[model samples]
Target: MTHLSGGPALPQERRLVTAVPGPKSLELLARKNAAVAAGVGVTLPVFVTRAGGGVLEDVDGNSLIDFGSGIAVASVGNSAEAVVRRATEQLEAFTHTCFMVTPYEGYVEVAERLAELTPGDHPKKSALFNSGAEAVENAVKIARAHTRRTAVVVFDHGYHGRTNLTMALTAKNMPYKQGFGPFAPEVYRVPLAYPFRWKGDAQACAAEAAEAAIDQITKQIGAENVAAVIIEPIAGEGGFIEPAKGFLPRIAEFAKANGIVFVADEIQTGFCRTGQWFACEDEGIVPDLITTAKGIAGGLPLAAVTGRAEIMDAAHSGGLGGTYGGNPVACAAALGSIETMKELDLPARARRIEEIMKPRLAALMDKYDVIGEVRGRGAMIAVELVASGTRDGAKEPDAATAAAVAKACHAAGLVVLTCGTYGNVLRFLPPLVIGEDLLNEGLDIIESAFAGR
Candidate 1:
């Protein structure tokens, strides 16, 4: 197994030479507080100097286990050789030509690969962008132009992006939407078939949620006015909630019947993160449009909107693009990332991650009442926390316990992240290149945190 990640071969072990945030990190933290905006948040205060494989080496000389993978962007490891090599070559050749003015072969090549890799065998087309929000916004634009409709439908417990329209589509309020109202109009919200929180079994939940969504569109929004129905195959930022079995297919059928575009927001679940090239492939969903980012270009800022050729080409000439859309360097990184995923069989790697992680998380649930559920597919896994000591443990979300456990893990040199509408989920997104030994060590830190709690 080619386990040697980019930088100096970091030994697969945890080493804390100083306190979690030692003198150097503390100094930088002070500087960050003075210069950085207050709205920006930092999960762990430590300053990272280098990261690869399963470890992040901080400026303080602490080798912390990376469980978040920079929010699932570093699936091939932080500095995979191919990504670094291609990006370096591209950088040396030319950093930017502003593809709008003078296009390059790299950008076209990346889009071609996306056309081939994204779900569906139908004739497809792609347009690249700078972020997931950009891709989603463009997808909405294309759908509206094609259908000549104004209304767009999204689901509860689904997060699209942080931009104006995406924030309107997002369900959560406190952080993402609190004081940012007066959002874009013509966006409608519906129910998702969230299995853990739904009223019945998986099949029943799927059936009921589909009916509820259809009913809402028929009455509240009016199906004729709708342009698209967008959803995450495995909803990220809404606690990694995977819809109940059969839910997506039913929704897709509804959209097809109504002439509404079906969009899969695969920002966090794409690029082999969910044991498949795209999460929509699991249920054979062929969306009219798909938004991708985060893991698409290693760690570079790149995203794309790929879909059926007819739908994607509906927008008129010069209708969609940005100043930095499909920048040459980011395109190079994306091509390298795709090559690495194929050569290394990262889809199988993600499945192996699930095999190792799900069992441990399930065991944790078995022992702790605070853990209400262990859910998600492949590497995109999460544990929902609920208040303990009650007969029905899943009744109340336990944000306090989740916070404490995250703090404990940070103190012990394990980088972990938390998410969910209620702030009660601990998400694990280890890099696909992470070694089993280092993965176990990070889990050990989590186990110790829970035991102490």
Candidate 2:
């Protein structure tokens, strides 16, 4: 393998032989559409045949630089050497026994690693699950069990998951919660510190908003009835919104004083996606419970809840676990992914991605009156679009502009994804191992698309 200054060298620059959903991808898509559920959203039409580091090759002989990283699941890069090797070796030995039933070294090893790597020097424990939503639901269960409280508080624009309880925790309605609710009860929503739109000093605004939210919660539901306050250090699906500098620390203090559990849902922001092992560390706030998924196990479905020992122990003997939770194969992948992350210093690489993206996005904001804001931490970044010239004039995002730019990027051989409540934000979650040349090429496509060139 070729080596670059920090990591492996990129194979080559992007090349497109046909339309994005070229003949091969279109043919496979037609077959997939016939059998797969329509509700499953497909971001780009291109079908990947091979991928490594930062590039995805389609069956139609097109190479596209991946900026989405399979929705932040490939932080170590697609087909990471360590992950592939470990997974293959584990496949040769064993696949599944269900950690709860049979127990295994891999499962225990991963749990121990999590406890060590997660924030806080206190005694911590971890439990593995199948997805971010499961970890979130379990976190609530543990919090409630420990505090003997009923209500759980979540913030606006915070995305927990799609499960019933998490659905209630989530803020966006359409697609996620739209015809699917009769959502679980005992969940409440509060306003978050969105600095871009709010007026005042960033830190003061965050502290005041958090204090007001706590006051509202106490006045309305009473802290005695509350179980936990869940938040994303940097809101992921919620347009990559980063809480103001002092926001997380203030919230952590409020939770501590009120005897409420603080849950950090790091599903998208974890595993070095945000230039740190955990985004909460940026503010030096140690959450009582932290939910993780996305990049934990390379591309495997493994989620975890790591937190204080007392709280986690509150659950009954059989209260936490699942049939496929902590599958051995997935555990192996997680081990490899974590090892690769440390050995290669992916967090520093993530900072490099931020360094590269910030200026390009800033240029876009300067050139396009339609671009409203560019925000995020490290490689987990997003650009929000608004109709030209409007402060309070219909703050609704421009979905059409987002869709047009995404389509143009695809046509020009770049893979991108759109997010946000109004679908007006373009999020970039490129693998930390991405090559500089390929990343710049993808950014160029974004610029060209915005310029309507």
Candidate 3:
């Protein structure tokens, strides 16, 4: 019952003292437009001055319910209690000597924790990094070294990261990989068993998609040339698409049989976001390599590639690591975050979030014609909008409706976010520590948005 999040002390209730992007925020937005990079985007155009528990207090004095949790990075909540305490202590003690240069116990402790926490009981090893993209890129490097192969397989609608190699692995184009072309070679794309969009016979989609993906690899690239099969157990930016049952297992089995490393890119779905320490555990899928980042350090920049010791150690001594990799402060924060997760049993809390959110979103689907489907697990739920919501499952995406609804939610002091390759999925990644009342209020705002209230 001890589910606490530490941040600026503020009321948890929603209070719109002014418009979401009120005078102060508007002033800041004006400055940002002039000073910041054009490519950088703003979701609500509000400047957060404080955040904690379930609410974000903007500079405009509006308390917005935080449904996005800074894209799931603050699952333990912004400035989580332990995170602040440990990071403060570490910061005051010593910032960095770089594990590769001077080494530190904090780094080793974080690595050991990763080995203990990540899926599988096998002897595991981990290499820490600064971002999810870095973790993913290194995972590929390790896979290639271990398998001594070049081809890497990823699925359609799978978003790995924004870096060159990762961008190549990512399937979306517009915002992620449009002009950044001439991407890394040797990465192959395959079909995902996305249930909602699967052509026919939903129950058989998993077997069919697995076979299709396997056939493509066997014929297109040849299994011997493949280094790894990387995937998100639940697709993130490309919509929170949870692949059909049996598909993941089949792919993992195929990779194991062919000596292809199976990597679960659990960047967005890890650390209790999906009711488990890692989403792969939902299906009992133990990857050869798993990349984690977003929630690892409770909002700090920390990422890791953890896997079987043999695969993780395949690279030479100096092959892996960065100047900022496993910095003492981030390591300390990660330890604190992990401690908080276990102490609070955030995985169970995430399940509680699912229990509270999914039904409400499903109810919204029932009430709105624009809602195509309500999908996702634990705190990572989403509502896929279509031209017409139907139990039969309409496929036409209604991006306009999604955008309008999200805009309305923001105006009403609810911090909502949208995703999907088609840009028609409204995603919700509430901090696990969010109170039930705030959760309900956020849901009420969603209902109002759809009702045009």
Clash count, predicted structure 2: 0
For candidate 1, lDDT tens digit of each residue in 112-231? Answer: 998999888899999999999999999999999999999999999999888999999999997999898889999999999997888665559988999999999999999999999999
Off by over 4 Å in 1: 1-4, 200-203, 390-394
Q: Between prediction 1 and prediction 3, which has the larger lDDT? A: 3
- Quote the lDDT for 103 in model 1: 92
Give the total clashing residue pairs for model 1: 0
What is the alpha-carbon lDDT of model 3 when measured against the actual structure? 0.92
RMSD of 3: 1.4
- For all candidates in order, the CA lDDT equals 0.91, 0.88, 0.92
lDDT of 2 by residue, 1-453 (tens): 222222233465688888888999999999889989999868887888777787888999998888988999989987777888888889899999878888989988998999998999889899999999999999999999999998999998989899999999999997799999799999998878887756666557787788778888989889888899999999888888887777788878988988999999999999999999999999898899999999999899999999999999999999999999999889999999999999889899999999999999999898887888889989998998888776235555788998999999988988889888778899999888888888888898899998883
User: Candidate 2 — which residues are off by over 4 angstroms?
Assistant: 1-10, 199-204, 391-396
Question: Model 2 RMSD to the real structure?
Answer: 2.0
